[model samples]
Target: MKRAALVPEFTVPSPERLPDMWPGREVELDGLKAYVRDTPAAAPGAEPAVYVHGLGGSSTNWTDLAGVLAGRLDGQAIDLPGFGYSDPARSYSLAAMASHIVRWVEHSGRGPVHLFGNSMGGAAVVVAAALRPDLVRSLTLISPAMPFLDPRRSLQGPIVPLLLLPNAAKLAARRMSSMEPEALASMVIESCYADPTRYPEQRRLEAIEEARRRHLVPWYAEAYVGSLRGLVSSFLRAYLPGEGSMWKMAARIKAPTLVIAGRQDRLVDIRTAPQVARLIPDSRLMMLEGVGHVAQMEVPRTVARAVFGMLDELQEDKAGRAATQQVATQVRDGVRQRAPRVRMAS
Candidate 1:
């Protein structure tokens, strides 16, 4: 396949530029307001991409990954409604989250973008891609919280029962509220990373600060609980035969996709990664050793390389098609020119 000269291949050097977390601000679009942070690309005419965080995560979760890929992709990471700095929405279901992503892409006119998601955010983008294929160019899922029929084996098992309780989110929120910010941050780091020590001290401080700020939000509990319940419901529907199944939705995705799984992910099962890759027609899988649920955070450079490789291949595919079409046109033109002109006797 011919390689396109449209852009030079992107590479990340050791100690790649890790800029401070991109400045964030509230942005309202299509009547939905979200806290968005933009990471500008150094590469000219770099394609645009959007990052969606998992449950309980904010846009800041993508800081390091986006930073390393800045030369290749201009990135925007949004705070899903009810998480981060975004205000609560009427619903925190998967469908609602997917719709918000679609609306944002439509309103911004950044269609056919490279869409990324992690954990619950991963599930949301799958729906978004299936719903509006024209709006998505490619997909990258890192430890996506796909449907797990049995949560009993994972860290999520304990939280599953909350779905049955009355105002469970509210109740959990009250408990979480009393915990110190540092403690909450520690708990999160422990759960999300294979090696909590790898977590940068600066980011840890940021996480602690976010925990403190979240306590002030009236809807924090509602958002967390609502989103979790919605995720579990999707899991049930995915196994039953129907259009609601996440597996079916994944199979319907038209964009090229890359699924990354951490071997030590305590939240999402690594076994499901293969199933997800097989279901998506144009997809590849990467399983990282000794990595946890958040590979993007644990190994940003590695993830960036895989992402850039996909883009490079996509460019080559386009070039190959163009070359083939050109040759066919030329052959047809040559044959026409060589053939004797035909005319009726006058």
Candidate 2:
């Protein structure tokens, strides 16, 4: 592919430089709003990458990573329906979300993309990839919520249902809002990290503020409940034996994959990393020490490096195989010519 010359640096007017709240144009569906960041490339076959964020997160969560990836490949960061700038559909389920993603990828003319997902989004991507392997070139999952039967350790096992209990989640949100910002932030920190103090105070405050703002919205509780129900139902379905779960889907995935996690993630224990690695045949695992649930957010460069390293390895392996095949073809042709001469003499 021909590369375009880099644009010269220049200052922009305030109006031009200002960020758009939704970042990109909205893809409207009945009763739902989907936001997308579409970066057009000057050349063809640039390879498209799509990123999906986790629960309680918006497309903005991937701002840093998306920028890095977009520079490397034509890419988009999507606000999954019911999260971030996206509004909820009448029926919010994992299947529905996955289906929406599939439609969006197809609609974008970027079917079969390099797919990236975090937490719950990771699970959704995994299911989607398994169901539509032809639409995925590769996968990168960060702290994916895989199904676990152990209730004591898994965060999704218990809290998911609680969040789905009709109006119960709204009541809890109301109560949570009443607490002091520092106290609420600390509570969230305790659940998300091994050591809350390791995280910067400003980042923690930002998280608290985001949560507070989300809670204040009237429809927030309904959205939360619907999403939680979908997550929990998917988790349960994935845990079942034989045919219908994530475990089954994991074994079906043919795409090269990278699974990343933080050793100190309190919500989803790091122990699940090896299991995920083992389940996905073509997958590699990377675990970072002293990090928490949001490893990419906490260490963007590190995450980017790990992801890019995997891509490099995959490329190298492909090139090596091609070279080996070429050499083998040459040797076979030489043997064929030699055999023809010997038969002529005979």
Candidate 3:
């Protein structure tokens, strides 16, 4: 049974600055440079969580939420190969990305982690959990992109899924390359948040700076388009047998899962979250009324509360199992001590 939600004892953070978030450090995962969240003083044996970001998002997306959960979870948000500061690999398929993360979790010996993701990364984690259930202990998805399942909204730029076609995708990539980071970031904010103006000025400025940094990378646009294609491709394979599908994979997950979606989310349809929650056997779905795409970033305190609640449930369940095992052991020991001794004919 799920435990009562914890009342997180903290104020909701204003928009965060880069320096305030965990610094980026290079790490090797899948033989590629995987930039990850670096926290020098994370508590030992705290529940380890691996955070993944969406299309056009980097590990930096977890800045606020990770900080809030730091007391309870030792979090490492990864820059997925080709996005954020990570180097790109040849393959950009959803399965390939998920496999890379699976490798990272196993190689780093951080398995059975609480897997947290947003947008495209959210979909990737779902695939990872399905592929390597041993690696994921729980899943928390924020506006996971169900590309095939998501309908195109006008506020978002030209339908990118169809843009994935050869000529169109190339044209889209070129256009994005020419666009300024400020413009790009502003566009993202308008599309992502229900009320972008509601975001703090300092945070908005930091995001603009982040966009500028992203523009400096020659392959940034390529990475964004590749992620969009990967998401679309994954959506196409959802019901196919033996193929990696998020919906199909969700059914196979054995861990406790929490899915949070913003009622005003414009990217992946808000309707998708409920079905996702329904698919995962032991999952909880929480919808924030006035929130948008990035719930973890926009409402860290509330999101942290949900995470703590999941942790509470996990702890209780673990204790119960341990008690059962101890009782069984005791009963076996008592039977052995009290049993009558019979000598067999020699």
Candidate 4:
């Protein structure tokens, strides 16, 4: 395939240059508000890459990374049902969230796509690609949640996991509901950062503002717990015997894959990242130093370079395989010609 010059990577923009929010609108798919990235010129037929954010996160997570890849491919980041400004489904499960993603991709008429997922979103895309390989061309997973049960922290502090106990969902929701939006945002900003002080001040305000917007949703608290519960349940099932296992889903995925994580990641442990890379055949792993859980957000340009490198390698592998097949065909034809001719008996 002919190509345009690839997008330049690793040019980390100043906070002043980074948009507080990307231009977008909520798309109604099956009556759910699927907010997606609408800027950054996308090349036609280049296969759009869909972005899925982690638990308690929305499509806004892809803001920086999408800009880095905008020139090379079309991009869209979904606010997966109930997390962003989206409406809730009757039930929220890992499988159902993944299905919602699949439906959105199918509905958009963009298949064999370059799929990107972060944290819990990583698990969602794994399931989506496993269930419908035809819809994915490649997968880029950043700190995917694959069952590390050290729920010592739940974005707030060490005791948040205790809220998961039986008959605790409502109480947890009520307590979380009572906290100010800034307080919640501050906890997230603190937990996700390797140096909490370094994450830009303007972005901090944007995050707090984003949190305030979410607080306006009638069921935001319930949805948050529901999403968390679903992720924990998924972690437990990842080890079980069946097609449901995350390992099994990962093994079943046919798309070329990339797994990346930060050495200083506190939310999802870096140790678990390699286990995912080892389970998924032919996948690549890149562990960044001095980075945290949200690698894309913290160092968008660097992550873009890694993704660009992966795509370049994937293309080369395809070309090499094609050449090998052509050579084998030539060799077979030569053998046929060199073989002794059979005598006709009559």
Candidate 5:
């Protein structure tokens, strides 16, 4: 049986911005708003990194990681359609989200980019990279929601969608709203972190306050349902083996890959990490002990190091390959030039 806590032990912080910390370009399209930040490439040939967030999450979830990664490489993070400040769309699916990312990449004119995602967002990166290998130079997945047979162990499978059900979701929202801001904040931390005590009280309160405000919107139920439906459907399709599922496509991924998982995650079990590492041929896995579902949020520095480390490796690999090709071409040209001289001497 799964363990359930009646009350959270820590205090939640109030929701307030620290000012210009998460400032970025805001693009509005089809009623959705995408918050994008661009960090120029550190080196002429360095590829930019693009980040996508998971379900019920906003780009803010990646604020810390983005700031750290931006210093090392060109980076960007966006709120997927219908989540965060982004407006709702008619449909939500991994493929649909991947398509949106492709457009974003093309519009940014960043050339090829390194991709990173958490949970559902991680799955989206995988699908996007598979669809357009030329546009993606490498991939870093933090607790990617791949195919899993056990529904009880996967948050994306059933529990999330159940919470999104019209009446049930509204009831849940109401219940959460009724709690004190501090209590609500504590609940959010409990759900988000394996060790909620590690998070600052202010951050937790801010998250709870945001949830409280969102609950007041009349169409919040509709948005919740749409988002959950898309996630559950995608989760199903990605898990079925021999179904041309996303897991099957993982083998086709040629980009250097890095998958990070939190051993203490209650939402998506850590057992999925090794399988993911095995499927992607050129991939490595980094499991963090005493962490939860949102490792990026829970331990930003560690996540940043693992993710940027992979980006560095990819850059080095590309440089090495380019040099090898250049040398091979020169050697071939020299052999051709000497062929006629050798024939005449003979």
Candidate 6:
């Protein structure tokens, strides 16, 4: 059974958003440069929350959800290397991605943070949390791209074989260069959303603009294909019974976790949601209906509610533990006071 958490009493907060994606600046992480959008919390003294986007996604992917949770978390959504204006990295392996996250958190001096990841980012964070437990206080995974054997129905299935081709990135880049930004955006929307109409028209326009920028970048297709190859490698490791397995890494994660899966997600299978919950010792699971791979984008309010709910439960648990300790101390003190004179021969 999933570990139990207190039922929070609060209601889901109404979403707040800007006309466009939250503005951000580039930050240097050692030699790796990354772009991140910051969303300050509505309340003071809020804990830091770092968001990592999925393959092909940028920090903008978390814009809506980050705004919705701004009351509780000081959100920073990062654009991983080779995606979304971030400098390209030498490697696109899952381990490399996790290392980037680790380095960023360390560089920020923000250890023991609330870390959030989606799809490929989710798998990366799992490794990060496992690698350095002290760096993470909590984990929230949205439709994490866990390893799956049957890719026939998955969104990435058709492209699996393409990884074997020589100069795959160059080939893919050439093919993508021939397509318009609108077409690419439309393809992503159709592939990711359970209901295309739910996506805001303005956001659709933003996506197209983002796609146009991406097409102009030298590493756009390289990043996409390279990350895909890394993800598939991770999938292969999952089947092997060894220390390199992601399942093993996930099982080692010590932080309290929240796993959100979209029932209609075409990329990651919802059937694996239970497995994810089970593997992570202290975790809560939320399966959303009529939602696709990007639940945070499709239903920001609901995602925010679940996130806040987890925070509330953790807060209550802390309070309860403190109260219990206080009562125990008081009871011991009372006993000592009553029998103090006759105690201790020394």
Best by lDDT: 6
User: Least accurate stretch of 10 residues (summed lDDT) in model 2?
Assistant: 1-10
Of candidates 5 and 1, the better by TM-score:
1
* Alpha carbon deviation, residue 324, candidate 1 (Å): 1.0
Query: What ranges in model 5 sit over 4 Å off?
Result: 1-20, 30-32, 38-46, 154-176, 179-181, 216-218, 238-244, 342-346
List candidate 6 stretches off by more than 4 Å. 1-10, 16-19, 342-346
Error of 4 at 238 (Å): 2.1
Which wins on lDDT, candidate 1 or candidate 2?
A: 1
Q: What CA RMSD would you report for each candidate?
A: 3.2, 7.1, 3.2, 4.6, 7.3, 2.4
Displacement of residue 296 (Cα, Å) in model 1 is: 0.7
lDDT tens digits by residue: candidate 3, 1-346: 2322655556333335533657878987656788888543245668778999988888878887888777778888998887778998677788888888898888779778889989888888888888788888899888877544535542443565465467654666677768787787888888888878777676778778878887577777667677777777677788676656678788887888888889998887777888888888888888899999999878778888888887888889999999999999999999999999899998
Count of backbone clashes for each model? 1, 3, 0, 1, 9, 0
lDDT of 6 by residue, 85-133 (tens): 8999999999999999998898888677899999999999999999999
Task: Quote the lDDT for 69 in model 3.
Answer: 75
Candidate 4 residue pairs in clash (backbone atoms < 3 Å): 112-135
Instruction: Name the lDDT value of residue 316 in candidate 1.
Output: 89
Task: Assess each prediction's global lDDT (C-alpha) against the native.
Answer: 0.88, 0.71, 0.78, 0.79, 0.71, 0.88
Model 5 residue pairs with clashes: 12-205, 13-204, 13-205, 13-206, 14-205, 14-206, 15-206, 32-87, 147-239
Give the TM-score comparing model 6 with the true structure, all chains together.
0.94
The worst-scoring run of ten residues by lDDT in candidate 5 lies at 1-10
